[model samples]
Target chain A: MLRNTPIKRKLTVIILLISTAVLLITCAAFFAYDLFTFRQSMVAHLSTLAEMTASTSTAALAFDNPKDAQETLSALKAEQHIVAACLYDKDGKFFAAYPANSPTNNFPTAPEPAGLRFEGSYLVAFQPAMQSGGLQGTLYLKSDMGALYERIRLYSLIVLLVMLGSFIVAYLLSSLLQSQISQPLLQLAETAKAVSERQDYSVRAAKLGRDEFGLLTDAFNNMLEQIHNRDLALQEAQQKLRQHADDLEKRVAERTARLSETIAELEAFSYSISHDMRAPLRAMQGYSDYVMENYGEKIGPEGQQYLQRINRAGMRLDTLIQDILSYSRAARAQMDLHPVDLEKLLDDIIQQYPGFQPPQVEITIEKPLGSVIAHEASLTQVISNLLGNAIKFVQPGQTPRIKIRAEPRGDDLRLWFEDNGIGIASKDLNRIFAIFERVHAERTYEGTGIGLSIVRKAIERMGGQVGVESELGKGSKFWIQIKKS
Target chain B: MAVLGNILNPSKEASNRRFTHRLRACLAGFIFLLLAINAPAQISREYQLKAVFLYNFAQFTEWPPDAFADPQAPLVIGVLGRDPFGAYLDEAVRGEKINGRPLIVQRYSGIQDVQNTHILFISDSESKHLLPILASLQGRSILTVSDMEDFVPRGGMVRFLTTNNKIQLKINVNAVKAARLSISSKILRSAEIFPPAAK
Candidate 1:
């Protein structure tokens, strides 16, 4: 039982030990006092007996009456403890004796000198039989001392009984009182355990008494209250955080939809205006060409030169309108991505484009390009524009040397287009992908400046990135990053 | 004195007309009595000791200055009537003295002849004469002694008895006082005394 309830056991043991010790000390002292006085009283009795025996036997010994001396000594037999008595004449010889059992064989042949002492279990007293101005003889009395031992035995038994009784009472009282301490302690432990397991800090321990356990219970309840309050506060804060995040996400989605609608409307205006402007421009160009061809001789040299300029100006205006339409279409379009065979695509592009055939300008695939996820049309437009720019911007006497390569970067592919051409300056490099952004003059580049801008928008719509790295007087390397299948 | 000397020694062959004849007859009776006794050797040894004790008492006791006729006079120890001590008492007191005076033993037939006696031993044979003997020694400095029962109560100075195989002494101080005898405390110390107030 003590294994689980050590406090109760300890209290009982402590009480028992204390009571036993007190009982032992008290009983020991009582026994000591009783024994001390018992022995002292025994000595006193023996002394009195010796004195009386000497007084009565004095006359008998002085008279040399052996029978009288023997009778006087025989009187001692009436006393229970007395075992033997004797009288000696003044010469210290054995005069007369009265042994308990007759014949007196155990008596010493000669009398011992006068004294009192203990021998074995007997107390021997030798007193002088004295009279007025005379010492007649010595009287010897031997008394048994077994009575003192019996008294001690009796006292020991009583002490044992007292010890046993007190020990039992202490045990009972200790056991009854120990519950006052152990009950509340057990309740507190169980409460603490339950609170931790369930993470519910509302449980409180029971108070058993107006003592330390009560104080502990109060403190425990206070701590649980604080924890319960803190728990509720933390839960409220978390809920608020979650609600704020959802509200912010909803607002961001609404704003994103509105901005996309506005961008589509603006793109519609630019596309419709470009398409309407295309008709007048085409008509102007065709009529100019007809005038230049049909009435060359009827008009003079100056008139013919003016007709040629007008035809050229009309053709340039048509090109600018076509480039603006493509750029506008690349930005304001839905995206469709697929896994396209880039090697086959590049082969088809080379076949479709006359500028990509070897000799005049060369393009090589440094490594086989893996299939990647891209919008087919946008990927084709982006690659085609980069190849065209590469062939167009070259040194005056040099053939365009362009290289195509694809390499893996994490989960995406970096498709590189390197060219031997005049590189842009560092200050204008970041702006090269902007709408209608150009660094070279129009007449020098012989193309509209919208190519790189269209390449950036098309790649961006396909969820890819476009960038160019160059140093003047060297070459340019342009990369488009698209996700791998 | 001559009768006591004969009583002290059987070989002295005392010339008592009646005593010599009784002595011869008593010698035969004594031999028969010795033969009849259960322990003659021990009884005779004990009586011989009592005889010596009587002589010692006479030696130790003091008497009045004029109890003897002169400084050279003998200290007399008288045995009255039948001499139960036989010749032992005389043999014990022979060649002994008390206070520069020679010792003598006397035999008396009656209380009238107990005069000038320092110690009078009343034998058991004359138990009938104990009263008159005590009366005659009453005012004299004479020590009256006996071996009879209740002798001390009857105003005798000393008495002898045996019990537990040892001789014992009894005394009456009143008798000693009436006789004006001065008994030594050492002698009285070993004697059973009566009339306890006169100790």
Candidate 2:
């Protein structure tokens, strides 16, 4: 029943229970001893009374005087506990009785052997009256056990009182002393509760003594100290991480700005260099034509052939420079996209160049080619370069067959340029679109390497993708995809 | 004139007197025979009781050291006159001891004949000489007993009195004390004291 009570109450209850048990046992033992001894002393007392009455009555019995014996027996009246007494002659005849006029039936008809015994609630004694070392008569006495019962009642009261007093004292003492242990534990509990509730580890329990509770408090404080320190260290680490992230972001932004400025300056320098070199080349071409026409007879055939070689080299260099300029322009141009008819663009391109005439090359524009969203100028340059490469890379003396078509693909339009040409190897396919990378030898193909590079850059700037499908010694298929209008 | 005439006829008168005397003697003998049949049993019972009383006195009374010749001497109960108890007193004290002393019955012809006696029952035959007998045995520690009237008043220690067919005791405490013999209170509680208290 006491389990789970506060420590103080539990201690008090335990002490009270132990003391009550001990007191009850001790009182019970004492009560039993008192009852036993009281019975014994009662017997002794009755025997003594019987012996006195018997001794005094002996002379009366011997002298044959009933009155004297009666008087002797009457002395028992002074002892209130003795209820009745009588005397018998040596012949065992009833002689005299106490209270002189008491009924004969009150006395035994005959005397029993001399001894003391308890009969029900009475103590009875039969003592021999001796005279001259002869058995003169017997003396009989009966006493009530009222005194014994009275003593028992008194002892029970005393035992009960003692037990009550002892229990109260035990309770009081335990209540006072239990706090010595419970106080320290309660303080530690409060400290722990505070730590959890606030998520703060700076609080400590007060040490009340140099005991186990004190040691527990010390350990608790030490744990709190470690937790507090770790919390601070974690916060410091998180703050340092945030600062490093901010610095990295700032450095990346600064580097990106500087790189973009350097790229603009390099693009401007290349554009001006290409533009200035073109003026000089144009002047050189005019003067060479003038020399050929005016001094035709005086110069002769060898000088004229050398002038023609110089003129051809100058034209190739000019084409190479113009391809480089076109590549650079494709890389840096701003695109404005709108829908353009693929069939119309293909027809215009075929008519613009005599190289695309029917006797020279077969150009078939698939009718109803889908229109797409693209930068028109970049799309024209990409298609023109693809058609030029198709015609230039064909087998010797074979008619170039070019098939141009467009198809709708999801949200975009795909344009295909199929040509019968000397195809590229699989290993060199990936590097085909790089600037100045010519797969065929200059003497055999007679072309600059930047045309495919310009085509790829112009398509990427217009937000489209371009790829090729070709096998060696067979035709190649080049396709580009752009959003459909 | 009639008396002078009877004197002339004397023979006849003497014969008449002889007849009357014989008749009286026969009647007396018959009465005595009847008394003899009844009195002896009563007297024997009385003395039997007195003999037991004598034995009892020895138990209840304590004598000085000089009362015995030695620690082992027998307590002698002496009869100084006609021994009324006959063998009854002997029977009462047979195989009995008082404080480790054996008890014995003795008969004395005179006061001088009483030697080493703790108790002496002076019979009615010595009633005439009781005063002198008690006086002569004054300094001695003997318990002197008798059934005579005024025995305790005359310096006898104890007396047996018969009243209403029951025997009772009267003790002279003064005489008992003077003899240096102490009677137990048990005996005193049941006895009449001499020199009765004044009302």
Candidate 3:
């Protein structure tokens, strides 16, 4: 985050310089304090000598005997490193002084400590001798302090020089150390910048030492390694996802092609049954009709009965052919499912059966014949076929009562086509709907036994199930359950 | 003082000429005597010349009245500590004297016995005692000398140094202040003044 800044270098350098300066300043201050105290003490010493001399020699100066005063003054002058001695009375009168060769009372005088500039110069101190003879005199004495100042000043100068020299040395040494530290840090910063801006993890930080900078470089290299690994993982994951999508697309394409082939084969089988079987059935019926019509006048009643058998056989053959056609059409029809009104469908079926007038026809259709997912034409055929079978199989002297009902059963529609008719025998009920099978003699019922079989095939093609429940001489109910896909 | 007067009396031109002629003859005679006493000047010639000059300096000097506590006391030329000249200086000062005092040699390890020493020769190794020795002999008739760089600058009486690879001496005028001893101007002229070299 701080790639563009030289914050590390700045912080390192600033800390080094500040600490070095603080140490140097502290040492210098201590040395200076020592030097100032030594100077102060030296000045105090000189002033003390001056005061002592002034006090001791006040009495000797007051005596006023030139010879005794001169002798006393000479003794004072004998002090080592004394330049000249002067006896001053309490009244500030000069009685005598050593080195009488000079102009009397005209010797050079300094503030207190004399000859501080030159080494080994004299210091003059006055001592006043208080006599018991009521004669107050001053005795002057001189003491040299020039050597003391010289030694102190020399010592202080040496300390000052050493302090300055050490400070410079320390500053230079610290600066060198800071460079050693900061140079690598600066290089590391450059490497980090290059890594981020150029996205080049190959550039590694330069390792400078076995210190903290080297450790930081190791950490940086590790972080780059992790980033590189994650990048590779993401790319691999993306590639895998692409491969999965491609496999799914290919499978869907293959399944759709196989479904198209199955639909074509079903259409071809339906077409062949419709055209080929209908022609042969038509020829059979036509030949039978011609024989019965021409031979009826020439033959007697016995011959006429035989001719009638031929005609009935032909008619049965024709019903079989028609049932086959119906089955083929249901199987091959283009399925278009929509919302179907079963009430409207049943009313139309009843009107189509006007010629086969039974005593009465009672049709009850439940309200809300619900809409469903189905082909409209196929569903219409399903309702019409079941209703026609119910009308045709009515019992003698009994009006047909047909009820059409629909209700939801799970995710499908359960439709019921129930009627009261000559029901099937219990043993033959399972086999009654098979092709070419008759439950009774040919004269008893007029059907090819193909109607229920066709209905089953048609309802089954529409993705529905069909079943019947009945008892002999009682009634039968048929149910069709079609699932909503 | 008399040798300085003879050398610097420029107004006595004819006498000065005669003096120079006689000095040349004396120089020849001294050379002759030096040969008779020892060998001719060869290597270590400076050592030989310095020994002869040291003997001359002792003879020309005059000590104070109380310098010798004993009347028959030797005019001791004490060689304190190491003496680099070996037997050459001993041979040169065999019978030298100043003001009728015989030249005697004394060797001392401490400054306590330095009181009566008229001429004190300090070696380089005994530099630490030079100042104290100077102080002890204050107001006495002692001439101090050493062999070191600028010894007179460090408050010695006379310093012996090597200039141009030749042994030479330096004298400090301020060192003679308390002693009240006047050095011959001829000697002063011959030796280099130490104050200028010190500065």
Candidate 4:
């Protein structure tokens, strides 16, 4: 029942309980001793009174003088607790009684053997009346226990008063002293509560003494001191980390801006160089034609052949510059995409190009080729480049039979170009789509190496992918994947 | 036949009267004996109580060392003049001792015969000689007791008085002191002290 009481109340209750028990036991022991002694003294006092009376009355009993004996017995009235008394002669006959006229029945029928005893509520004595060496008669005395009872009642009152006084003092002392232990404990508890609730480790309990409680308070404050320092260190570290991250982000953005500016300048420089070179080459080709026509017999066959070689080299150079421009345009152009029918685009390209006619190559378009979302110029460039490569790379005297078809994927359309050609070897396949990379010699293939690079660049700008599947001397299958309309 | 029956009738009547008188006497004696057995106080004859009183005087009074020849000497209770106690005084003191001394009853015809006696009881016959008897025993430590009137005033140490059928005592403390004997206060408390306080 006392488990949940506060420390202050618990200490006070413990002290009070201990004091009360000790006081109760001490008072009880004293009270018991007093009662025992009181009874012994009462018996001793009554025995003395009885012996005195018995000795005095012996003359009366021996002389057979009832009046004298009555007078002797009546003297006991001065001692009020003696209620009645009588004398018995040597013949054991009742002789006289106290109060002079008390009835015979008020006395015992026969005197008992001599000595004092307690009978009911009275202390009775039968003392032998002796004179010298003779027992003249017996004297009987009855004293009520009123005096002993009165003593007991008075003693109880005193004991009760003493107990009450002790309890009051005990209570006062406990209340005053309990705070000595409880105060420091309560303060420590309050400090701990504040630390937990507010996450503030700065609070500390005040030390009240050089006891264990004070030591505990010291320890607690030291712990809070350590924690507060750690928390401050952690916050400082976090701030530094955030500042470093911001600085790194800003430096990256600055570097990326400088890199893009350099790339644009380089592109402009190349474009201008290609445009300027084309004019001078055109003039050289025109003058060569004029010289050949007017002076054909004067220069002879060697000069004419030399003029033809110069003209062919200029044409090849012009094609190489144009392929470079196309590749750069494919890389840098912004594409606006819309739906275009694959089968129709393929038919137009076939009609526009004379080399793709029936006498030069056999081209077949699947009737139901799917539509794709793409930019028109980029898709046209990509498909024409793929077909030109297919026809040009064929074995000598083998007619290029190219079949074009489209298939639908999940959210996209895939177009395939299959051809009978001298397919690329596995080792050179990865290098084939790079700028100015050609697997066959110019004398055999007769083309610039920029065509496939332009095809890959244009397809990527249109949000499509390109790949090829082939085996040596067997055939090649080229495919492009774009979003289906 | 009628004259003969008349003569026998007188004698028969006389004999019948004699028998009835004997029966009446026998019944009266029996009832008297019963009363004596049942009530000791009522049956105590005057001297029988006086004999007991003499014994009590021997018990309650103290004698000087000179009153006995030795520690074991008999405490002699002497009767002067005619002995009124008969064998009753002997019966009272028989097998009795006072302060470890045996009690012996003696008879003295006069004052000169009262030697070695601790308690001297003067019978009523010595009333005429009470003064000389007390005078001669004056220097001796003897407790003198009697039933004679004004016995203590006549220079005796103790007197037994029967008043209203109860035996009481009158003690002469002056005479007892003169004889070098002491009476217990217990005896004095239940007795009347003489050479009365005023005197």
Candidate 5:
């Protein structure tokens, strides 16, 4: 509020008005005093003149010599301010008058009482002509009041000049005093405004003097410095947080890129392993069969049996390689799950293989099986593996009997494939899902024991879960749970 | 006097004092005589001073109106016997007016010739007739002055005396008061005022 007011004008007005009032009062008092003194001295001087006139005219008035008295009164002509002077005989009548130019004839036709009086513009005094014995007559003097007025005129002129001088002096002094305060205040205001408007805390007000304004300026500057430092600290903290975020992002990007490279290299190794191992196995099988056929009679029955054994081992090794490849592919491939008709898919699998054709193996799917969320190829692969496992792991003198059905379970569809087969023992249930492991002896199984593991891996990759319930003499029921679309 | 002495002597006081002491005696008379004899063409400065003294005395003494023929009449100083002050007195009083009256010097061979005069100077030529001159002017406001020795003691109003070779005043206040005139105290202070001597 104070900042907005023009301090110089306010202070100057306050000081100037007060000083002018005081100066005018003082000058008026002085002028009044001087005027009073001038008037008093003028009266005193005229009184002296009256006394002198009376004394000198005593003899003339006593002797009744009007001429001498007139002459005595005429001497006052030398006194410029004495307009007229007259002498009154002892009879108290105007007798001898001075100067034909008697200012006015009203020089009191009758004698005035003895004393001095101010009459309009004149100072009239009455004095008795005194001798050693008695009163000779009265002397009347009328002096012009202009003398005192002259003094007043001079004093008035002096008063006017003095008033101007005092005003000028007061103005100059107020300017000097105001600059001491107002200049610093203005500087502080400017700096504070600059800081607030521009958010520039670096701006500082100047400390021009060791006064209150200076202290204020210092305080403002100090506050700005604190804000500037705080801002600097905040900026530093933000910079550090950003740097940390960037570092974190860079590390994550590097780790992700490295992980992708490792996955790609593993896929390439798996593919080559599957493809290369099969070729060599096929060549070995072909050579063994040729030996059995081309030199059957010459080698004898024992040699032919050993060669067949070698051929069977090669075929089993090739199947194991294919199982490994399928497991790796299921684990690494991106599978999109869609609703698949489990009934149709099972029927298609049966028709595609002669083993499931009627008398070879009994495969039954519950009619009108509902659809489920699953990857098309992976889901087919999984079901195929399960069917094949059922047939291969069956009890020795029984054809494989399989049943497929599905039921809704919460937000998911759980499908079950029940098969009449040599059931897995509860102890090997967890182990059954691992690769290259068989619950039964290899001679008893008659096949690689990798079908269930493949099924479990494929179902898991397609976002479905697989589990089994089995007994040693009865069949096993394997279930797959998938999210309902 | 100290200021005058110093002005005359920049370096020493002894010669200044001795020289002025010698000059004190008849300084006015000798100046008058030398100017009249050796420099006849020159105005006598000595009588000029005496003429001024006469007018100055008139200013201090108040006279009765009876001492003038009329208010318009001039104030007369009657030289009762010889006229010592020549044209110097007239020259000194030329165009001078005191109390609205001009001062005039009149020469008188005897007391009978003095009429309506405010002052009477008894010159040395009338020294023997001083008694009758004063007696004739008794009870009048005529200030009596003379250069005769023992004039104040002999009941004269003012006497010019030579003391320390300087012209000095001897006044008899009693005799002046007897003339019914008041002499200003200022003139009395500078004059050697005396009481009536033991008869």
Candidate 6:
């Protein structure tokens, strides 16, 4: 059975029909048995009565005092239960009879003693009688078997009547049982149909008994309860999800607003640095040019040198300002983390510096760098700064030997820039990474001291760590470790 | 023979109880019938089944040959007074024969008419006639049946009763033996056999 198909009606119908059938079969069997036995016993009794009457009617068959023989037989027949009697002669002829009655209008010939017996409205008996001359006659006597048959017939009729009555009763009972069970089952089916069609679960089945049907009803009710509970739970969960989505939308709106504000501030700050700062530098340059132009004849070489020094000082300040702006911008830059292939990046950066002739630098590059998750531009800046510093501080008369390698620490990428260069004094190593702090004077270095500081700031903004290793009169090695995320 | 012996020996108390029970059922049935006639024409199979059982029981029993002197004489079944079955029993058994004997039912007031009877059915209305009926029936071929207190011990052959408001029956073997009548064993298996009373 499918779980959905209700069987209460079918079950009740089967039980009632089976019970009725059993009852009918039992009654019919008994009726048939009774009919058989009644017929058998009636025949036996009639035969016995015929035999006894025949035995007593021997005198009538002999025709000795026929009147007395007839009277005796008549007396026997006169018994309240006896219907009629007759006597037959040995020649298969009628000799005397009782009650003056015959099943047929004419008396039937006496049957052969060895032949089959006959039965009808009369019950006849045969016996042999001795005559005075040693001769014998077959005596035949008959009595009505009507009453016996009538009794049996009446009994059979009564049984038939009873069977008919019981059948009607059984049929009615079966119908009643069918209705009682089918009504409830139909109701359940209708409710189930309605539930399926309308997708509603509110309807319930009525309990009819404590039988299997009743148990089924209870189960159905429980199922409905569970479905309703699950539905309620689902609704509650959906409501919670909706609430979470609304909260997320609110957070996204707030973040977008903050981002736009930050972008506006950056643009305004960049504009201020670009115009205001450059204007003063331009005026200083123009002033220095005027001084050189108007006082050229009176000025000695030292004076011209002083003017050149002033112009150079002004240009250095401009360059330093530009570097400061660049460093600040790199520090403030937002990161878009993605896969950065260091090998490809290092290769690209090194290619840009191909102008350095005799690229014979024994640069033992470790198995080219692998990809890491980081801000691609910021990570490239760190690498380029280190690589540029190594190229700049080369040992006199030594090939610019460099080794570039990478290592992963946890979720971070660590890169090493080792090179053969004019190593810094141990004491200056610490201060060299600070902004505007250089180991050699500006004249000898011919470079701003802001490179290492910018590198440190760039790495820090990208959530990374930077360090240096150096010994006076040896090459320096700089290392940077960046969080992969 | 065991069945007949058991049926011929029933206890006084059990017979009395059965008699009272039968009397009550007869009264209840009569009342129910009266109520039924006006109430509706619905068939009461329960009552009909009882009637059928009683009719069948008659078929299974045999009367002595002397019980009928003339073959035409009615096999009188006499009820002393107050017929309990009304006319339903009569109608059910009408024109019926048992053992080549035509059935006849009558109400008698005294023992003088009892000699012609084959069965003397003593209802509660004729309870007072018990002793006289017994005395007249002693050593005779008559089968005495009754629904009365201690009817079996008092020498009635059969007692009808009600249990759980359903019809039931009890038998007295001693009474049957005394009547010189042979009851069938099939009927005895179902009937509640009461032991003979202690003298």
Q: Which candidate leads the pack in TM-score?
A: 4
lDDT of 5 at A141: 88
RMSD of 3: 24.3
- Candidate-wise lDDT, in order: 0.78, 0.83, 0.63, 0.83, 0.76, 0.65
Question: Residue by residue across A47-94, what tens digits does model 4's lDDT show?
Answer: 999888888788777667677788888889899899999988887888
Candidate 4 docking class: acceptable
lDDT of 4: 0.83
Predicted complex 1: CAPRI docking category: incorrect
lDDT of 5 by residue, B1-199 (tens): 0000011111122235456445543453575576545332222343444565676667667887677778778988778887767887888667777777887888888889988788888877787777888888888889998777767878899876544323456789998888888886645544577883566
TM-score of each: 0.53, 0.57, 0.34, 0.61, 0.38, 0.38
- Summarize candidate 6's per-residue lDDT along B1-199 as a digit string, tens digits: 0001111112234447578556656655775677755321222333343343344445545677787887666667667776655565577568776555677767776667666777667767667767777877788877666656578767777876544433456788877876778776544645667674466
Q: What is the C-alpha lDDT profile of model 3 across B1-199, one tens digit per residue?
A: 0011011111122225568556655654675676653322332354554554455556444566677787667777777777656677888767654455576777777778776777887765576666776677677778777665546777777776554444445788777554666565434544678576543
Q: What is the TM-score of model 1 when looking only at chain B?
A: 0.75
**Candidate that beats the other on TM-score, 1 or 2, i.e. the better one:** 2
How close to the true structure is residue B140 of candidate 2, measured as C-alpha lDDT? 91
Model 3 stretches astray by more than 4 angstroms = A1-266, A296-324, A336-339, A354-363, A372-374, A386-485, B1-199
TM-scores for chain B, listed for all candidates: 0.75, 0.80, 0.68, 0.76, 0.75, 0.70
- Which is superior by lDDT, 1 or 6? 1
- Each prediction's DockQ against the real complex: 0.08, 0.21, 0.01, 0.28, 0.01, 0.01
Worst-scoring 10-residue span by lDDT in model 5 chain A: A59-68
The reply for model 6, stretches above 4 Å from the true place, is A1-8, A39-248, A271-348, A354-386, A389-485, B1-199
Error of 5 at A311 (Å): 53
Task: Give the 10-residue window scoring lowest on summed lDDT in candidate 2 chain A.
Answer: A58-67
Candidate achieving higher DockQ, 4 or 5: 4
- Give the distance in Å from residue A401's predicted Cα in candidate 3 to where it truly belongs: 6.6
> Across residues A29-102, which tens digit of lDDT does each residue of candidate 6 receive?
87678767865675577566555555444433322234445665766644455555555555555555666544
lDDT, candidate 3, A158-244, per-residue tens: 767766676577666766676777787788888889989998766778788878888998888788888878877888999999999
Candidate 5 residues A307-376, lDDT tens each?
8889889988988888778877787778877777777777787788887677877877677777777887
The number of the candidate with the highest DockQ is: 4
